[model samples]
Target: MRFELARLFLLERKQSDAFERRAADGSKLNREQWLREVFSQEIDFIHRKSERRFVPDQSRPKGEQRIVARIGRKTLSHENDPNDHLKEITREQWRACLVIIDPTSHDDGQKVAIETSSIVGSGFGNFESLITTINGHSPPEPFVIELHSITDQTTFWEYVDRHKGKITSIALEVVMPNMFGGSSSFEEDAKQLRDKEKARKIKETIENEDGLEPETERMRDAVSYATRGGGKVKAKAKGATPYDSTRDKKYIEADVDSENRDINQKTEAAIEAFNKDENEAVVEKEV
Candidate 1:
């Protein structure tokens, strides 16, 4: 039972399409309201267009993490498609109470204590992909929404501003590289450096320079341990639209495994009842 906040922005893929299209009031239709409406579609839409669900079902430089919604295949059968979890919708807002799980992690049992958020799960794209299938093509205009974990991220930029130069260590999520380094430095060389200088160097190396010229890469989040004047004053390193410190908050946690959060037994019972009723009606008609 986790909650998240997200906002959607629409982008028109075709400038020509934008020129030809307008809403009822003649305002340019660029808010991706159409995509929003798609998510609000009837529950049956899930089954009608369900397919091999992907983490980000759209726009990837490489491949996506395959989201297994069932025991063996891409989607569940004799049960509900988990994508039907859209709970409420309005012109300005929508809510989805999704049940997302990582089967492998739970099975491994280091302790099944993490809650997989929709932002880091197939919940983002499962329904979106189905809508595309129903439409027979991709939406000319698509929407992008952002979600950040507020848990473990109690401190905001305001705190950082107050502390300023006191920042002891800042851990960042290295987002995109201008050019791929054959040997990338994923983590800091914590063994060699000393004091506050270590933290500064870790951040500076990625953002300031490679050797001579500086091609600063975009860091997704920065997690700082603490800021100390002399003592070990600890602060946590978080994200840009930053993710929280919890293990479940990271996308990599579920990059290899996936599961549906839907109540299988409840759905199965409903399906059974429907089938029984249908069979009875057919028998009466035959008689």
Candidate 2:
């Protein structure tokens, strides 16, 4: 009755002859739209009727809109634990098919043309058999891979690399951020401001008076200490490897306390100074 079962019959079992018989009996033109209609009906039914069954079963709240196969929560059932049920229906078994519902603009009367070719290029259609072959009993996990931006390839690789071994279904969806007001100026100005802010931070940190100052007061002290015999104290303390000494020019001691009260006081002061400097550094960045 479900699309998944129909698909399983058609693809996995190769029952085209049987499919034609069922299609005629069901009064459907062809199997494809019939399958989609069945799937839509099932989704609607589950949404309206399955709520009570799902309430206690699925403990966690789902996103506002989500593909049930990939991100939906599961509940403990009479048959098995939640984990076992989820393991039975994992993303590793099938791929996903996604469609983006972009928000339309009433002001400019313009729709952003998202390049779907790249998504198609990413082997989206390769999962047609998988999607068709799914059974409702154990639907393969569906990943709604939404491209928030066409220019950003990082997100694409992240999804691919992260789920290379586990992905069964890949549904590509894309949506541009909804624009507000009758102006493109806000978006353009925001971009320019971000670029300018980045440049300002880079220039100030590199070529300004603050750039000449030590990053932290403790760092200054550490530099001074290194220049004096204090560097040898840090260099020789417990766990002082040549590599560690060369890089940090400081000691690493697990169980050793300060050798004297004077050293202890300086270390305490240095730590306090370092913490103060760290906070001030963050505050400066915010300003």
Candidate 3:
């Protein structure tokens, strides 16, 4: 008897690669023939030497495919892998190749999983890139979640190249609430609390009864103060300095981009503040 098997990724997210497929008529490509035809490029993995067959004599619901793969194994090389001479093997595994093209951004990687690692230890193959390629969708550039300081120069350039044409302008801000460690966004709860408190304080400080300035101006003023550094300005609206020698550090070495671009007023203020010592250390960065 053949084994009935699958690893359900129907609840998987629709990230850059993990998406669904559709027919030319804007319908679900759920039929065996349709799926086989749609996943032609994926099934054609050079090393996998895989063949897919449609089993119609199964007692299953509609849109459920009885796609079987008789895949040939090959030794795959992985860098810095602890295992030596990696190899794979598989039987004629029967799985429901779930290609749900329900016509929405929300989709599961069921088909992607079925094509890749549905039955194998490391997965049969990665159909994500193939999907992107076939659909003319380019892979997203890596979104770096790193410390404002201690950035790798070589890696930074690589990222810059990836980011070109995607962004029109780039602005740097002094990262706030130095606290760290948490899930979801790796942003700490305490940091979030601190940010909330900071926002509250800014609202209180900026919205004086004398003449209420625009909320945007107040926020920008506070950001300029925090990023530019704290020094008692003659004016009140300009004195949203949250960070000072009493609060955090009096100052920090500002990273200045070498690119020839117009710096906004906030940036200009920050630069002016940082240049008090004239010879104040500045890092030349362009990204």
Candidate 4:
């Protein structure tokens, strides 16, 4: 049996409306600008850059790589039509999820998988339950779920009911493998060069600068002094108010002079004690 795949696109309804309005007005905003400025901020838009890839199939070799160019074309005139504006916005493919259901296994209950860009094969029972769960929780706005192989509405509803409430646990599966090489190497090399250049510039500035080292040394010394004994060195001026002694320059000078006098007295006393000890030792030796 030939298997058919269905594509579902998720869009932001409010953002799409605003975009349509802008398009109708012939505003200068482009697709990328609309996405970045308006769509990205909306809760349903799933803010991220859309990735383009080449899918490998029977027509293409497994190892073959193709670079999918970014969508750069301007919006077409037909896209501005009221009926077609929604389709144009959806074609941007910013956010989307996939639904896969097996129609032949209706007796055993159809198997269903809801897949998104980050998550895939999240099993769900029944289409109603899936819709309920998604909408009840955090629903992506303006979503379309397309089912392939099941052409009739009766078959679709039957499959949805068969798989209801029978969610299965399965490991994450990779739907597509990226085989392209060297696409990201340029960015990586450029980043490395920029980092190296930044480091070199910083090193050169440090080496060539004159006053930075001395200034840093002075700051270190000041910190050490403050931590050791500077906190106790309060200078007070004569005739200064007790509460405002710190703000008085004369009080500060007087306090400094007092501290210096105390240090000098201590030094003189130490010297005198040493001299007396030496004289006593000489007299004892002579005796």
Candidate 5:
């Protein structure tokens, strides 16, 4: 079955190649023959070779059909695999592929997985150029190309050439985001939370080491007071004195103390006056 399928793929590739050749030579080829050649079984051996080099190891369940294809670095997998008619696999296998790809990551490595629908929809070509570009620009070697589908290989190739020798083997796989089934994307979100936690810890460290808490509170209080006074605490006007030992810091402190003392005295006087008034009223009633 694999050999036959490989042949089918070869025949299809040949048709496309022949059409390209004809077009290059300015010859209008017959569409009927092109279509026939694309589906012919004569190139089974060649197709087998291509499949061995490109197709992934896939097995489908009974009564459920699927499709899988890898061109260069991009692996396109779908059911019937509607992403393309060239897929020849099972739905279960397809689902498994999604699981595998969904977990496969490019974290700190050359192996990166991206959403094919997003990339192609945004007008990017295939996996080759994308991988090559990442390999060239991103650090480390042996970058992997991962996508659900590739629309353009030529662009990928061009991008690859721009960054030569950096890229090694291309590992293509169809990575689909889990929708309703299992907890897949949950892992990524968890990772993000962990990162945020780490950041919060680092910030705490800085605050402790730099005495940020008290300093920040003081600054905030100063701003609040300035706001109450209806004036902005402008960056100490250009040439303002930074500090002065003889400056009356005592004046401000004394003013605050005096205000508190006056408030206390006023409260004591009011209490005494109220008591005296109540006593006089009681004495007059007795008389």
Candidate 6:
């Protein structure tokens, strides 16, 4: 069967080659026959060497497989560190390729397991150059391509006309690096700051209220005074102060532990005042 297939392929190639030779010799060409011969060769090649026929069992279940083509030294990392310097140095050294995924024959789901092909480029200019290269010199072997970002679909389709049949689908994901901290973290910090401010306002209201005993007033004043320097103390505690590490050790460090203790005490005292007022009202009603 293999021998027969090989012979059939050789015969088809000979026919196509003969048409080219005839046209080169200034002979009146049969256009339809020439087109048929060219198409026949392409179909024969696809049937024999296309990557669609060799997908593994494990990948079939997922309906798609993703393979990253490592074309540069810098790779996507878990830490999400900046790679601007590395990318700048290795800009010219980058290369790109295409990835093809062929669907399995046994899929029964509504979502048709699409065979996707992606052409990767290091950057926009490099990608355009890569597309031109593919147009001029189409590679035979299937490659795994990584698209760290999306390319213009129109531009891509223009160059990929040759291998359109092998590609059943195209899926491109644009992966942008998270340079700024995540939105969730920023929102959480804002919420915490708001809550702390609310707590500080409540403590101030309790300290300024009239009709308290002299000792109670003195206690409230002391708590308020203690918590007044909380901003600087909190900044130091969180290592946000520029002078935190550089300060001379001859002077004693400001006690952040005491600052936290004072804030907690003031918050508790405000809550206790509310509870005490409620208890007194209940006692008066009983009497």
* Best-matching candidate per TM-score: 1
What TM-score would you give candidate 4 relative to the actual structure? 0.14
Pitting candidate 2 against candidate 6, the one with the higher lDDT is: 2
Q: Comparing 3 and 5 by TM-score, which wins?
A: 3
For each candidate in turn, the TM-score is: 0.28, 0.16, 0.19, 0.14, 0.13, 0.14
lDDT of 1: 0.28
- The sequence of per-residue lDDT tens digits that candidate 4 reaches over residues 1-287 is 01111211122233233224244456644422332222222122111232222111222223322111111111223344368555543233222222222222111112122321232121122222333333333333232122111111232223223443321211111111011111234223333543544211010111211112212343333222221111111211223211111121110001123435453343233333333433553575369
Report every candidate's CA lDDT.
Answer: 0.28, 0.25, 0.28, 0.24, 0.25, 0.23
Model 4's alpha-carbon lDDT is 0.24
Q: Per-residue lDDT tens digits of candidate 5, residues 57-136? A: 24422331122223222235554555767576654221111100111111111111222233222112333333334334
Report how far residue 80 has shifted in candidate 3, in Å. 36
Per-residue error for 86 in candidate 5, Å, reads 44
lDDT of 2 by residue, 1-287 (tens): 00110001111222233233234356523323333323332221122121111111121123311111111122433342376653444232221222211122222111111111222222122222223223332332121111111122233334434433433322221121122221244234433543544211110111222212222443333322222111211111122221112122111112224565343343333333333433553575369
Native-to-model Cα distance after best TM-score fit, residue 25 in candidate 5, in Å: 33
| Candidate 1 TM-score over all chains jointly | 0.28
Query: Candidate 3 — worst ten consecutive residues by lDDT sum?
Result: 141-150
Residues 17-50, model 3: lDDT tens digits:
3234555675544433333444342333332344
lDDT of 6 by residue, 63-147 (tens): 2231111111112233322665334232222222211211111111000111111322222223223223322323211211211
Number of the candidate with higher TM-score, 2 or 3:
3
Scanning candidate 5 in windows of ten residues, the lowest lDDT window is 1-10
Off by over 4 Å in 5: 1-53, 72-124, 127-287
